[model samples]
Target: MSRSPLEKFRTIFKRSSSNSSRSNSTQSENNSLTMGGENYDYDEPPLTPLELHGYKSTTKHRLLNKELAEELRQHVPALLQISHDWELLYSIEQSGTSLQTLYDKCQPQIGESVNRRRGYLIVVQDTRKNIFGAYINEHLRPLDKKIYYGNGDCFLWKLEKGDVKDLNNKHQSIEKKEVSLNLKVFPFTSVNDFVIYSNNQFISVGSGDGKFGLWIDSNLSIGASDSVDTFGNEPLSDRKKFYILGLEIWKIC
Candidate 1:
């Protein structure tokens, strides 16, 4: 009898089983190459783990300008009134004598005050007194609240022995000198002291002696003065270099 067709077909399938397994293995290896090996392009930059919210590359303090400083000084009188009113809350008793006495003592080198209504005194004058580095009795507020009139000029006035016009004019003369000194004097400080108006233009020259070096903003326009001592030694008739450090003119904007 001829071999049954079913048995023959079964034998053929058994013989080809190993070859079919080999073909499947080869196909899987090819799939691995297609799926596991490909170059990809990055679409975004990676961020570092450590970054501050408001960090700047440069940490230098800005150079203080004369116009800005003058602008800051103009607003102090109203703030002074506000500050003086705050002080009055504590002096409600004793005819407010202690406050008056303290005010009087600081006034000779500072300024005079006249009691206005109650718990208020109008500043009659500002003496432009420098105490170590602060304007004595010159109330300083934060930078944003400082007063200014038109064209970046300041509004300073005198009350005693002056009309409205005189008061306005007196401020002009006093402002130039005071503003000049303030630009130099405002930035130096010790452990117990801190700067009020720091333009960052001047460096603390004699931190131990409360002396700082500053360059006049006009130095660039007028040229460096060849006839004066600009730092420690008082200005002399001969040419002396003013060593005002941290006073880079480029820092002015």
Candidate 2:
């Protein structure tokens, strides 16, 4: 019950990104192996440095505001966050809501010649407004056989409501106050290598016995969260099961 915001994320470094939604149908049946499949030119102005800290790009994210992004940034491993900018790979609002679209948009960008690979951030916000998700070492690929696919970098995290209070300012200002945005990151406990699992049926992160740290159906409309040995995370959502309100995936580029 004492998990810090983003879990003790306030004590760590800081910055951004969540999501869920009901889709009319799957966007594409054929999976594309390419990353940034098409031009994602945005017409909106770039977010201020207040949001992203150092990384700069014109792409405006749907779920990631400056506060959330900065809060989550503190929890990421230094190797991943040091000089990298988060690039949008898949978004339920910008891209289609289909789970397959997530796989396609997040296709691995590294090649055999490259020694380093980008990290994946999967952020999900449920209907109840709980923002939580996982970081993956590899791109998502739905397998035909039942098996887990990511490495040790995979972990679960969440954004929590910091103490909110009324602000007493000059001229008796009462509208704005300092709000705390905390983050909690649950790293791999090494309980099992089951860091990530994906198949045509669904995609999941963290596992122990039969419970999963986070579970999202292939439809991407609903999801569930539970404490698991892999992450030792608290139930990410208030309820055992929740409807996906928004989903977004960002890659450390």
Report lDDT per candidate: 0.24, 0.67
| Residue 117 alpha-carbon offset, candidate 1, angstroms | 15
Top candidate on lDDT is 2
**What global local distance difference test value does model 1 have?**
0.24
Off by over 4 Å in 1: 1-73, 81-104, 107-134, 137-253
Clashing pairs in 1: none
Candidate 2 per-residue lDDT over residues 126-175, each given as its tens digit: 77667788888887888888778777777898766322111111222222
Candidate with the greatest TM-score versus the true structure = 2
Global CA lDDT computed for model 2: 0.67
RMSD per candidate (Å) reads: 28.3, 18.7
> Which stretches of candidate 2 lie above 4 Å from their native place?
1-61, 109-114, 161-178
